[model samples]
Target: MATLTHRRIPGRVRDMPSDFPQVPVQDNETSLDGPREAKAFLYKFSQAVEESDWKSFEGLFAEQCWWKDHLTLTFDKRTIQGRQGISSAWQSLAPQRKPRGFSIAGPGIEMVETPPAFVRMTPQMATLDIPFAFSVSRPDCACVGIAKAIPSASSWKIWVLTTSVVSLKEYPFQPLPRAVTSNDLISPEQRGKATPQGLPHFQEALDAVVIGGGCSGLSNLIMLDSIGANVACFDLGSPGEAWLQRYRSVRLHHPNFMIQLPKYPVPADIASTHLNGAELAQYMSRAVQDLKLPLFAGVKVTSNVFDQERRLWTVSLEEVQSGQTSTVQTRNIIISHGFYFNEDCPVIPEGLKDRGKFSGPVQHTTQFSTTDLYEGKRTVIVGSGNSAHDIAKFLGDNAAVQSVTMLQRSPTAVFDFDTFHPFITALYQGNIPVDTADFLFSQLPLGILRDWMGGAIAELVKSSEKLYSKLEAKGYLIDRKPNFIQRVYEDRVRSIYFDAAGAFDLVLRDRIKIAHGTVVGFTENGLIVKDAETEAERILEADGVVLATGYAKTDLPKQWAKSGFLDAESALQIENMGMPAVDVEGEMIGQVTRSGHPQLYFSGYIFSAARSFSRFVAIQIMADINGQAPEHGLP
Candidate 1:
């Protein structure tokens, strides 16, 4: 078997150039030669690619452009800008992968079995997105590509190209072996306990080693296990400890049914749309034990050493309580510190004065589990986000509380979540299979979604005029000025506070007071805030302060390098990523950062990341270890 080092994805993700040459506007209805030209272009395009004709490939693209590949030819999600780079990549992989059978989707080319996928136009960008299907020479691979075309002198030229693996012939997504929801119909004794349990200790060496046992880590673990991969997961605390440690009142922002893990899902019988923190933790823990997943709880991954020559990884684990240590070698390492995504670690603002003079309870929202201790005391909650909103509402609903104030520096956008967001109604709630739902939802390109959503968001924003007028009366600074794209993607969490959180409802009724200002510093009695509009200083008296400020970003890569046998260059090759910002190029970052160590994968951030994107990770790793012999790992 050939050494797998040559398959390394670039360590650093190439940031797409911002100064793109704008496309000249044409009539959206007729600019694109509609399906005819698109079919011909793709037909020739597939021929050129499969035959390794670089010249033809280059000629088909515009002078300046970007090609975004998502687990297709590259088997990794990334965007390549410029004709040269894209051509070079396709030229290298096309021959080995043998990507042929191109069609306008309905052409019914030989070996192509996809439906009539068609061309779509974006009036905002004056670009046409043409979806096509193709076959790969590699066993068990089905590929799809979307080409974005702009007007040229005579016809359309490929501006931005996108390719992805729709499915694998060998590893198709299957329903969980057991019922995801718990069955309560049987009596406790009749149900009977399992006769035995799957061992928690993993084999000394494995195909994949997963770090971080939070939601994302567990999701990945479930997927890899379902596919029969020799995998194990390790975390510093018990499984689901991240959620277990949160406030009791903390509930999921989305519905329980829609927020399904890879295999284990929340029981469908729950009455509320929201699942509180405890319920979430129990579901995660039960999934591990019931499935008998190889999850080593209360263990930390202190070091991970990757060997490019042998294409393996030696991971060192440490027991949190006894200081015991062990090592195991594997072909791949997945870093899924779920909490580290965009919402770093808990951040304590610098301005809080800690002198003995200001003697009152101060805590982050994560720490403020209940209002039992400070029932009659005035409370001021810092930050304006999911946690902050929920905390404020929680405090307001308690009649024992004297007053509750929400301190936020930035503007916020609020909307009825189920009504406003399409995901809740369109794909997740329907009768479609979970696998099909997740795949289709994941495949919707951001470039097209942004254009499609901008107008809808604009309409929604206009309709909220009455809502905004009420919020303004309550001293709330609405996100009146929002970038159409950012409102949906990048600035989504910060700006759009879901109505499910209920902070908005309380504020409208004066139950939870709203204060829009910057916390310049903390006062003896409360925080010193500068009004957002006036810049005038004011002091709000509070018996306690809950800093709902976001979690600070953890340096997981640096932490992993602590004890690993990393060469200087290999060390340099490791990188991590959260959600990429939203834009033409930024949206492509949703794929795991493919640069850095070839054997290392850090799938961090976003709720569904590890689950939604884990199949590719499993596929890539399985591909690497297929023909290779299992080496004696570090003892």
Candidate 2:
């Protein structure tokens, strides 16, 4: 690799109050008292990156920290393994890097939902998403990258960094640098290896078989084994592959504290308080090691058949590494397997299915990652979720990409990465004992009277000109008091606002483009949009298009339902909208497929309906399942 001297590029900075809408730091909530600490930390951290100050960045890590960035699909992306590992990853990248645009203290924190669950543990981790532009050689050549960080001690530090060079053709409207070819980013090995093929069954003689090694499966296995239940758990290899398989720029909305699984805590020394998909997955892997839990990697459970004569559930599995088939019989069956394994890709656009005709490379969000493949192509990303935002922002920095447009169906609720502080994380996980009815009544949009009161209080405080004095006068003594309900409202409100606002700004500045309308259909050449007011359809051209549309629930096993243990209606009873139906009690109305099958249960993401508030937080789901298991006799 050739060494490139680092140069600083000027960019706009966002102004976030050091203590605006501040709240009292409650120990139980894991709140940090003031913004001075946060602001200073951001300043120093930003400086380190700006100047390639590796030592300063390294100094920010905790001794026991773990680093991860799965969303970028850069499984081998830069991570500060331990406090010192920060320097290791950076030193290598520093030799050929340039810095462009810097913004510190991206967003403020807010609580979402709080409910009591099985896990009562306090807040333990925090994470943040930091955005930047990277320049390789000429000043005009820049790419977008994300630095996801978490809180350590009194300051924040980088946990993971994923950058990709983009092209002008991809973002013709944006003022980004030229595109980088696959040779510039992806390694030969990554591109050459075939996607992992399904393996033959592993013929291991096991007493118990567990499917899905994600948090839920891992947790169930740990408990079953602890109770001396002979058990073997399995998931497709890559430990936290799902996280790695996502678009690279994604970050969790909740903090690390609420995401940790039982007996496997988020490391006290994590690189960031918030985590991206990769980091979360890495943490899961570390948990397996730290807990010394027995886990089978690269193993997939193809089927689970129950035998009426044997009075046992037969679990069939395939080991990707070794070509063999195996079956196991368990005294009791625990279905902790989650639902995110398969991709819920949209029905291929009628005319675009034969993508070769479009004369451009098109891909799914599931396969979308860095900008190496997008350096010089015009890109149109479909969908309005976080995945779409990440890809748009990433491609916006490319020079070769002619233009980038993010198509949306409707506005979405967006929140700052910081809103996921450990305390807030707990709140989002619905683990806090706060009243849900009260929160909804007080926080929902219809609660106008309460919002007005909050607004009045805010006005008075602003009038005082001194937040601390205003707080003290109101029998409060904080620099700023976070409007609980307003904060909640802002979380949803700001997501739509920020993305739209940011996209609008990009448009005004000619950095990117935005279109709002209903997608009528897809043509071989481009898309047709129906204008809401004019009711007229307009066609647009593009070099490539990506569906940022969200995912759907995984299809349930046909075999299980075929056994007569579960009825279609009863199954629907468990489904809430696109998610699975879970009771407030976190109980999944599991059906015994065999009709006479013994007590069987379902937990994890597949059980989405009842997991509403805490679905984003895996640890919360684990706690809920553990707490509710006894009621269903799930052992």
Candidate 3:
């Protein structure tokens, strides 16, 4: 194994941009009515913070105020209530832990007024649209802080502060160079005349043919390659293209440690809290390259036939870009194409398929990107999943959007990100290594974990009655079942949304309308949605419709058959393979057929955490190829 030198990037803070736009002001104004007072308060606050005047800072906040930190200042998640608690938390910082310098400036300020019924704090609060910078000298790291202020007793105080490390942009962690020597990567000349196996093969007979090139596929390939297996990976698009194709704003809800690729730990310095789509894609590509895995990008598998007598799989591959084709033989096949291979749009009832009559664009959520194109249009986003909420929030935030509505046919389980943040922080942020944390987390049985999480969620809901009550009053359906995690387990689908992304707040504010109904059909100018309870139909006028209905569970064998990758008989055999049943040793029970589908495997489609599950899957694959028991139970 090769190692890279650890370097800490320097941190710095800068003033907010002068021309930055402020948040739109609300109708009510109490204390700190305008930007003038807010600006003065911010200046004084920054000065006191720089001077380490905990006493002065403590005096600014009310006796009972909320302070939330998201991966800023502390490199951990923290929610401190009450001025004394906040002061104690700050005062407890190590002597050497003070930021080198901190400054604040902003585009402007706006006053946000919350209903007295919604919060225990003052109803009227001033929110400064300030940009802040924090730097530490010892570690040489810097970050940009997006800070806001609210009215406390007699003056304005810091309410919410969110930070993103600035150094990750300039200094990202790079994977080690390719491990394969010259002889390891077979040359085209060598491949042309190679006939190690009697069957027709491209390059050579591979130990395994791994399909798909997303996070799961790449992780499996890396592990197999490390174990010296002759494996080749194939994908219809570029490696990591699945992640690259997500919406621009899509980000992993899990923390850094939870989502690391197999064998490759995400360096702590490279934005080590969360990753957006682009960052994740880059990391996947690097992992593939660093492992020197044989990845055939832009190649699609066209046919696969199992030869029972030979105990081998004859596979045909087609180059998607060019019309070229080839063949290969493999001892094993691993389907890593993900669970949601098929997009699931709502079933349009009879008489609703008049495509020529509808005037606007209708597309699945996968096809929808930023809201730049829908500027003056009234858009209706269908569904209540994470994507739906994200899209709705994006559209609601866009000033140019005439109107945005989210149509939810059923209740969705939504939890605030804060509920899980502290636990994740405790598990992965401090002394605990990611592998150790993952091992400890996996040690708990699925049912036990679900029950524990249910209790925690119940407590969280009870504690946040004000917030939940507000959501319910706004007509948003909230699931009152076994909490979010248990509900997810029961449904076998990720039907939960993290509420910290501002979507729930927007719904409550009526900035994003929520319509509870099933979409019956589309009219010439809009959609006909029927209420579930009343069965009353209402026309929702929209210039565009986004179907955030999610994807169908992919039947791998059936998909392969439809795509001409498997013969009818073999496809039927696999179709009947039924629900995946795993033995105690983590091997698939009854997955292989009499026709010699040597260890046809399914992975990466479970409801648990994908990264952790993929790690176990890779181990299982390695164990199967090497004829050893898996170190851990099946994924």
Best prediction by lDDT: 1
True-structure RMSD for candidate 3? 18.3
| Pairs clashing within candidate 3 | 9-140, 10-140, 10-141, 10-142, 11-141, 11-142, 12-142, 13-133
> Candidates' lDDT values, in order?
0.63, 0.44, 0.56
Question: Candidate 1 at residue 446, lDDT?
Answer: 50
* TM-scores for every predicted model: 0.77, 0.50, 0.63
lDDT string for model 3 (381-465, tens) is: 8888888888888788988988999888888777777874675456566354454444334333233344546666677667667
Candidate 1 vs. true structure, TM-score: 0.77
Which whole-number lDDT from 0 to 100 does residue 524 have in model 2?
65
Candidate that beats the other on lDDT, 2 or 3, i.e. the better one: 3
Ranking by TM-score: 1, 3, 2
Of models 1 and 3, which has the larger lDDT? 1
**Tens digit of per-residue lDDT, candidate 1, span 1-635:** 11123223322122224323356455555444566667777777877876778998888888877776666666555556678887887777766666777766533322222333224333345555566777674545766666767667876678777666655667654444423223112122221111112123434467788888777787777776666566778877776566767666678876655666776667665456667877776777777766666677777777777676777777877777778787888887887765243334567776774534566778876577787755888888888777788888888888998889988788776665644655344666645545445544554345444545555667777877888899889988777545544543443355557677667788989988887788777777877888878999998788888888875645544543453534445555554343334323454332343435657676655564456567666666665666421221111
Across 1-635, the per-residue lDDT of candidate 2 in tens digits comes to 00011111111111111111112333543343323443455567668866778887787654544333211111111122355654565555444443434433122201112211112111332344444433433212324444445554565554444343322111112111112233222122221111233332333333345566766776565544433334456677656777787677666654554555643457876787668778877787776655545566776666665555664566666667775767555534445554433354343445444554455667777778777676666678776555666678768866777788876554443322322133233343544322221122222111323344355445544544443342233221132344433322222111222232133334445566666666666666677777767889887777678876544444454433554433443333232222333221112223111112233344444211122111112211222223311111011
Q: Model 1: how large is the Cα RMSD against the reference?
A: 7.1
Q: Which rank order by lDDT, best down to worst? A: 1, 3, 2
Better by TM-score, candidate 3 or 1: 1
Q: What is the C-alpha local distance difference test score of candidate 2? A: 0.44
Off by over 4 Å in 2: 1-208, 340-356, 416-510, 553-579, 582-598, 606-635
